[model samples]
Target: MSKVQAPELKKYMDKLLFVNLQGHRKVSGYLRGFDIFLNLVLDEAREEGTADKVECGTVVIRGNSVTSMELLAAR
Candidate 1:
């Protein structure tokens, strides 16, 4: 879904999410953990770019630092 509410997040746990962060960085990963404030921990995260992506094992992102997040359709 393009718009994600708090409740929707929980239902989509362990699913893929595209996360936009500050400084024009974007990532997609399995949604491992999150909090009420939107702080997130992503597993098997991949940094998006024009070239080959850099594999990020795991990432913890602060709630305030996140710009947006989109739930990706399951494969």
Candidate 2:
């Protein structure tokens, strides 16, 4: 059967997210904490590497201690 796509997904854009943290415990529940987490992550990623930054429709993070992260289109 063919799958139907959601409208929200259609408008989704890619983003390069970043987070700065030396230890693992520091980044725990970072995203759930507040808006700052999002900002921090995006900033860190840019510092780590030279990548294109864009708006992300959705952000999913795994692992407790996140040294860094880069957001991109989930293909």
Best by lDDT: 1
lDDT of 2 by residue, 1-75 (tens): 987443232222333334544543222121222231223222222223235444343334333344654334342
Top candidate when judged by TM-score against the true structure: 1
Report how far residue 40 has shifted in candidate 2, in Å: 13
Instruction: Give candidate 1's error at residue 32 in angstroms.
Output: 0.9
Candidates in order: C-alpha RMSD to true structure: 5.6, 13.2
User: Clashes in model 2: which pairs?
Assistant: 17-71, 18-41, 18-42, 18-45, 19-41
lDDT of 1 by residue, 1-75 (tens): 575556347876898889999989999899888887788989889999878898998999888889999988564
Clashes of 1: 0
